[model samples]
Target: MGLFILCFLTTGGALDYLYFDAFTPSGPTLPAATLFSLGAASMITLAAYHGGGSLILGSLGAERPDTQIPEHRELRNIVTEMALASGAAMPQVYVIYDPAPNALATGTNDKNSAICVTTGLLALLDREETQGVVAHEMSHIRNEDILLMTMVSILLGGIAILADLGRRGFYSPRAGQRLGRKTPLLLLPLSLLIGLAPLIGRILSMAVSRQREYLADATAAQYTRNPVGLARALEKIRDAAIPFRGATRGTAHLFFTSPLRRRLENSDSRLAHLLTTHPPINRRIELLYRMAGIMRPPVQNTRNASTRSA
Candidate 1:
């Protein structure tokens, strides 16, 4: 959150210098303009922070699961069970109509949270696996991972918006000459920072997301006492051929796995690893197996023996 605020402030400062200070000859003094810009940016940030959950759900087209439907009923049941197990309030349950198997938790806190699953997740996983998946999401809600990720996402969006504004203002015919004249010493560095802010914010978001995923996995195992179930669900998600059509880079980190069909996650290179939102599926599975005190199972009957043991 601190990092996100810093990026937002940096971008906001650049905008103030480029447009607020440069364009208005009789405007407020430089310090006053800067203060005003920062204050405005802070208000926007707080609003986005508080409302991020609804924004994410709306962006993903998440809808309340119809309890009249059997599958949706079962999904809600599993969510309720997990909620009780985690000592959290019953979160609103939602479903996405995508074919890709994925799930996410969102909201500011446990009482105000939601859990959404793809249609494919319901079709693909049996009751036990579904419980594991729901448990994972529930863990995110309980641990405040939902709040953290939502805020990061909002900040990332803010940085991208401010960066675009800075970029356009710097290159504009009138603003460019004025900016060059007003603060030539700061121009080059500020331009570079604005240009790179989005990438930098994305990297930071991914890094934080990856670590939270591991924590959620462990917490889920604790909640379910069945790490193999989540491990199996993850394996199915990893091998599923269909990608989520609705997923975008901006919302990719919120899912149980990366929803975008990118091969970068499979590479062994350090940079590729750094850029991914989730840790490697195999590594996560191995960690789960370690938690369960069992040897990793073979592919064909991975669930049978491990499920029994767990």
Candidate 2:
């Protein structure tokens, strides 16, 4: 859904660009989407390597020309092992000094993506659980879901910053100087639109994130050879109230669970749950259980990873 939206927005922008070329009114012309896609793709593909390294240890209420990863040794090793087992690119790893039990992967694409985890999370789960978390994120990497998600995040974030500037334009002394009466009228609707736009974008973004999560969970189950362990890991994170201290909403969806949130008690409700990025915990557990039928593996849990994974 987010990929579609990103393409749609870029399409809209490209159309705006092409409409200006109407003066030529030439015969065969490229669609707006093609040009927009090329521009966005070129940016990601060209700058991915540098961007990935820079973002790997960027701002977390600190300053460093080049910040060194805190737990580089273990995290990097686990990630490398997971990538090898899965036959995927070894995602770069970073640690947030924050005391929240959460982790996330971010980048323009697989080539440039960075995985970040808070110190709190490092302290929270055991190595197997950590492996499950890493495996899940790797699935995202393998599935190529990062491109659309990263685009949606950048677009929505820009829209928000632009909207805020638009709002400030009204009160700033520069308002009358830069924005004429026509400008205010123009910004009025645009501001309202931007304010609400991220909400809608998030819904769609979460929808895309949700599906990737299910697939990743299935993938983790396959790799770990113990659906029960992965499920148990999720259960611990879900039940733990240790909020990930510094996880901004900008990258929260990349975590193993809702890293900063406690499990919703009413999480089972149908209507509200639809809005969540992850499938319901019960749904995830149930899906893991069904894996037995699909993958035909041994069940380990005394009760059931299905019932408890939730």
Candidate 3:
């Protein structure tokens, strides 16, 4: 929904400026504006949701599981079991060669989805914990979180890119002529909006990511019938203390936990909390423990452990 609205706003804003310059001094005809806004927004939404998954996978160096290997076969089987439990179609599976204990899901919808896990995830977690992580990723597919997140990430990047271009265009001599001297007022407001859209879009996207992560965690507990499994998996992940070599802040929100090591691990400041893509690790573990009818206190030094072997 936020993605759709941002798309409409950015596209509509562009159209309005074009129409104002080309067709009428006032603005484009209402009917034309409406039609163009809807059309552009629809196209962008589809492109972001449908094509964005492959872009993400490629950027992260994820590849289809090498099914001939016993370990790859086991991973595929786990994904299939979780998908069946969730009543979602089996999704394509990928393996990230990185030695970080993390996994993420992608694709536009359940039928089109893919799941990728790091080699370290498979190496470090035992069967039950691996199942728990797979269940968590499957829950994201079942709830359509992958589609929303992939689209949001693309849209946020688009907002930033377009805003930069708009700023450059605004300062051009052609732009000065396009908006007459009397319309300098219009230029100021438009420029400010274009500059701010990226920052605003990023904050909103991060908030959405956090909320969806919480929901996916709960759904994973339901699907696995074992919140403790996920809780332990998270503990193992936290204890590893290794940064995901492939992770950038752009795709951090997609992972089972924040993929960067110690980036925001100890910050409890309100601003840091709000900017984080995932809820605090221990907080997430506590919620899972609650689901399992346990009330364990958060361990204070979960992030201090040495990096685990892959």
- Residue 190, model 2: lDDT of 43
Order of models, best TM-score first = 1, 3, 2
Extract clashing residue pairs from model 1: none
TM-scores of the models, in the order given: 0.88, 0.67, 0.83
At residue 268, give the lDDT of candidate 3: 61
The TM-score, computed over Cα atoms with residue i paired to residue i, of candidate 1 is 0.88
Give the per-residue lDDT of model 1 (tens digit) for 67-166. 8899999998899899999999999998999889999988899878999999999999999899999999999999889988887777777678778777
Tens-digit lDDT track for model 2 on 196-243? Answer: 555665666677777788888998877777676666566666555456
Instruction: Please tell me which predicted candidate would have the highest TM-score against the true structure.
Output: 1
Clashes of each: 0, 2, 0
What's the distance in Å from true for residue 14, model 2? 16
Shift in Å, residue 42, candidate 1: 2.6
- Candidate 2 positional error at 198, Å: 2.2
